[model samples]
Target: MAGAGWAPPRLDEFILTEPLGSGTYATVYKAYRKRDTREVVAIKCVNKRSLNRASVENLLTEIEILKTIRHPNIVELKDFQWDSDHIYLIMEFCAGGDLSRFIRTRRMLPEKVARVFLQQLACALKFLHDRNISHLDLKPQNILLSSPENPQLKLADFGFAQYMSPWDEKHVLRGSPLYMAPEMVCRQHYDSRADLWSVGVILYEALFGKPPFASRSFAELEEKIRSDRAVETDLVVEAVRKDQEGDASAAFSLYRKALEYFVPALHYESDARRKEAIRAKVRQYISRAEELKVLVTSSNKNLLEKGNPARELLKEMAKDKPRLCAALEVASAAIAKEEEGRDDSDALELYQQSLGELLLLLAAEPAGRRRELLHAEIQTLMARAEYLKDQIKMREAQSMGKEALAESVRSGCTLQ
Candidate 1:
């Protein structure tokens, strides 16, 4: 039975069990709500008498931001209390501790595990960005793990978070120097992309066991961050150029090189979410390479006559039926175009093969709009195959007529 006449719960209502940590602003404690002893929370108690005007405003900002944001990956703020001397914020207690501690203990996370963290962090960032919130201070220390066994991550510490519109041109520089973006280090205005740059630093550290740039002095670090080149980024750029230039082999090689960088990460990663993200990228690159190989080899008679590697690639890709069907469709179209005004037997064969793969996909596809689309595509391919058959027959007939006429002419002349 709770009523307005019931006195508000005092600071003693939450019995502090242990000291968790202390920061520049406040000390945190592991505590239990007395009414329900099972309910545990981390209470951040700030002494008001010691704070200046600016500090109080920063504290208020953090509270305002936390109160408005509700996300699974963001720490939950449960309750708050203010007395004449101090303010207390009761938040969800994470028993596993901060990510910084986890990383310190693990040394370097496997790429898969890093990817899992990256995905959740990215999702949290997107959620904040969507609402015009920028977490100016995003670092491993600000991320907490809910439990040791399951290890669900939650972003915490919003003291430096702020709301900024795209049109805003001015912003004060704040955040750890190691994770700061180039623009921020330069003391220039930046936007949400700055947060992504911090995320990139975290990702690099997670994968390589160290940040991309390091220096004894902050100035040197800033210089390194600005000038440092990412090998994978360069490879991706080159791959795209080669792809656009119609050099499928070169492009495929570059993409493979780019993918190799992630192999170590994937091999050591233990998290499923991270593993899947890496795997998805792997599939994308492989599928693209297969598609290009088909295009390059389809028109080359020499390549086809020498045991077409394009066909082999398609056979391999067929293991993933959806990807195989897509590759076959592209190959079929390219072959049809190349065979125009020439022998179309190759094109006819490709069409039939594509039809076969499409039928397999159609069979596997469930009853839905997607199945309907597959059925329509299959019908169109069948019609094209039929047309190719008729054209081939007409061409054969024309060849036979020409040979008979030539023989008659020779017989009439009789070696005159």
Candidate 2:
């Protein structure tokens, strides 16, 4: 309540221009402060007499949550007024409308644009979840864009939001069926993970032009969510799309979630063929990891060359670089062993290329603590590369010797 006084202001203090929209409990209006005509805001007017006790409590809860949280990607609550007839909430006006309308006009957003919005939404949700708040209802209709051109998203509509502890169990279903988590649909205990599941649904809709679990009826939709049948292939495609759009973090996060499904399938699989199929799925995750690493390294190089001041990007790379390098080493060794009696050129090439990408980072860094660590990594990789090269050469020599012996045996047989 930045400019609000102790008492509620008269409706005359604002000039209501046009009706933004109407909801079940409230009507939104585009309005301006009378004192400053240049300043515009959205007024959500809720009729007090029109609601039951539960609805009133929910409205008050929204106000409480909105007042406590302030973020760039979250709509701001600037002022409020309580009168005998109505409760007016003054909020930041978003001229670009909600994301649902935006998506409707475009059919589906381009991968780059969707990736940007998803990252922003993830950051906003992370902020809320870190503070123990669950939005409970997250969808395109609730995501407002700042403007048509910029399309900066702001999370709105907190009527169903709840504040819960990490260990608290939630069994109440309080969201749209299409966006609801499986636990929510099943009336089982859930937590902040439900919001993340909603995010996945939103991401799917953004990418595929329709919700993954879409159905004509609520029952069918619930069944789809409970089974999570539509998400398997779509998740992988969306992950790869994000990687192509150069959003390594989002791509990696999606791939990691996809990997979770395969892990359970692999564990419970009794049939050898089905187990092999699960192993192939696991290998896809490994491939995604490698692709993400390549994208991250390329972006890091560009940032370094341009002298960009994106410390967060640098921090992410530094944090994950070791684990990524270790995975690559393990994959290389496994492939080499698997191809021991055959040509292991592909495995050797993969090892060398991944090592080269790691070494490239050393050139971009100045001599410091980080550079020192990179030097140590380079030493380790060089040793591994040498060992792999020797193995390849020995295999090749053995192969050549066997060929020569076969040739001699053929010649002796012909002479006989």
Model number with the top lDDT: 2
lDDT of 1 by residue, 1-416 (tens): 23456332348677776667767777788888889566999988887877888778878888998888899899999978989977898999999998878887887787688888898998898999888888888888888899997788899888778787656554577788888888888888888778888898887776555666766777888777655233244556778899999876567556655555644444544554554455455556556755754654453445434434445454454555656557466655745564574756777777777777677766776787556645655565565555556445434433443343344345452223
> Cα lDDT of all candidates, in order?
0.70, 0.72
Q: Which stretches of candidate 1 lie over 4 Å from their true place?
A: 1-10, 228-259, 262-416
lDDT of 2 by residue, 210-248 (tens): 887778877787776555232455557888899888778
- Best candidate per TM-score, number? 2
Q: Name the runs in model 2 displaced over 4 angstroms.
A: 1-10, 228-416
Backbone clashes, candidate 2: 0
Question: Which 10-residue window in model 2 sums to the lowest lDDT?
Answer: 304-313
Task: Give me the displacement of residue 246 in model 1, in angstroms.
Answer: 44
What local lDDT score does residue 50 receive in model 2, on the 0 to 100 scale?
A: 85
Give the Cα error of residue 349 in candidate 2, in Å: 29
